[model samples]
Target: MTFQLRVLLVLAPILLPLRSSISQESAPTTTPLHRIVPQTPAELRELFRYTATRLPIVSAHRGGAGPGYPENCIATFEHTLAETFSMLEIDPRMTRDGHVVLHHDATLDRTTTGTGKLADKTLAELKQLRLKDSEGNVTDYQIPTLDEALRWAKGKTILVLDQKDVPLETRVGKISQHKAEAYAMMIVGSFKDVVACHRLNRDIMMEVMIPSHAKVQAFDALGVPWQNVIAFLGHVPPTDPSLYEAVHQKGASTMIGTSRNLDRVFHRRVRDAPDSLRRDYQMILGRGADVIETDLPREIGRLLYAPLSKSPLGHRLLRVE
Candidate 1:
């Protein structure tokens, strides 16, 4: 007890002062703020409202998982969170058990061990299967339900869910159930889907998926603002980078894909055909693509955030906003 008293006498003054300063630092300040982005949703929205020039943001295709983990699973979403990229593109489908699960195809043969259609399997049966990667390495990342993915991803990152062939209301309902309000960039496969989104989620910043050249004009005429669209001009060939201009003129964002099924990732596969080896990064970006969805999220983030070789358009504007 005498030794303890001696120690307390020696430390009390030092520890008490340290705690006093720590409390001061923890207290809030009354200064006004300047920055908006890398901030809350309201701040981000305000920043968007005032910005004059719109540079496309980085988006990870298929949760940014290359292999082992199943695409669009919780594992994939986790992988996207690891990178500097701010967004994730995932696919959502309903299981026979009436649960919303992440899977690209309607069939389980491509990514899962189960055979036949995804609707055929119960949630229990689906969980038993393994996930296959591009190289055919099957791992244990079982298909994660959309609710499961949302419960984890609500605040961390924006989810660009490729919701094809499913009821739009049903998918939106899953999001609403969480009450956490995760940003869902819904892929509008049809005009009906577009109409539904406009009517239902007017407050949410959406990215409607536009497929055709004609539909682009039609949607734009309907007063679908530039902020609400992401032109999914599929399989965009290098020779036709101009194909995106019409949509861009409408002031909407456009989505570019890069993979074996779409364009190549490398810009200078010179030995190959001009269109074959050259990824559409430069071309699509040249057209002012608002979002470039890439398979290599980390690598693409490096490229996107890299210092620009030239000054942007907003730099020269006489009355730049």
Candidate 2:
């Protein structure tokens, strides 16, 4: 045998193993994605159903908009889902061309590079502009249509569609068109809207404001089943604990938002008194809130990640990969 051939043969096995090891070590690492994906409308309803042993959930306001992530952007939704198993709250507005897009304001100057009334812009025009993060920093992401958001959220997370310029019938139509009854719910302004939504699609659930006992009685009078809703208790915790029981007794879960109130405290103390902020969040859940809608879902998710991962409800509805 030639000398070179003999040397190559001798080194072949060792070189091959080292090459394999290096390949294994250098392969891209995939961060485990955490998500809440319900497969059916019934499953979705069950996830929000109140129970003594139910695990608390987070609802991301504006898809958890933050540094480097623009509100109402699909990338931001995925970014938040990567950290925690939470439902996303999105805003849907109508464009001049009659296309439904996810946007929070009537004007685009505040959240995008564009500087006009959103209603004056066509979807094509809006698509040409990039979205800005909460800090007013521009991002690479473009505005996603409600259709795009609905398709993207199928097995990743639930989207709570906040009513913007879009009519209730249109929103309901979009949800039905997407067959998104399993993963999409809407926020209705009143008992009339609630009844309208229920009439439109019984399979689709809603987030309705039922913060007061009088409203609760009005809601109950509608004869719409509690399974059709996740009651929103406004921007702060209700002073009456019985209000919680009233809803819970009807087999519905309750959601309280911190984006306006407690979330301000959290952001202010994010550097100094974070632990106290966490305790305050825990206290909200302690007061019978099944869900906390917050601008800082990632923070609440960090606090909930461990226990929720082990809870029965989490095991059934949450996906970690």
Which candidate number would show the highest lDDT if scored against the true structure?
A: 2
Model 2 worst lDDT run, 10 consecutive residues: 19-28
Provide the overall lDDT of each model, using Cα atoms, as 2-decimal numbers: 0.56, 0.82
lDDT of 2 by residue, 85-170 (tens): 88999999999999999999999999999998999999999999999987899988899999999999888889999998899999
* Residue 107 of model 2, lDDT score: 98
lDDT, candidate 2, at 105: 90
Task: Give the total clashing residue pairs for model 2.
Answer: 0
TM-scores for every candidate against the unseen true structure: 0.70, 0.88
Model 1 alpha-carbon drift over 4 Å, by segment: 1-52, 180-182, 211-214, 237-251, 260-280, 306-321
lDDT score of model 1? 0.56
lDDT (tens digit, per residue) of candidate 1 on 1-321: 332232223223321112111111211123211111222334333323312255446677777665554577666555444434347778887778787788888898888788899987888888898888645678776888777877766545667667755688886666566653325556667767777766776544555556567777677677655555566766452345455666656655566666553324243332243333223344455544556677665445434442322324211111101
Where does model 2 exceed 4 Å of error?
1-30, 310-313
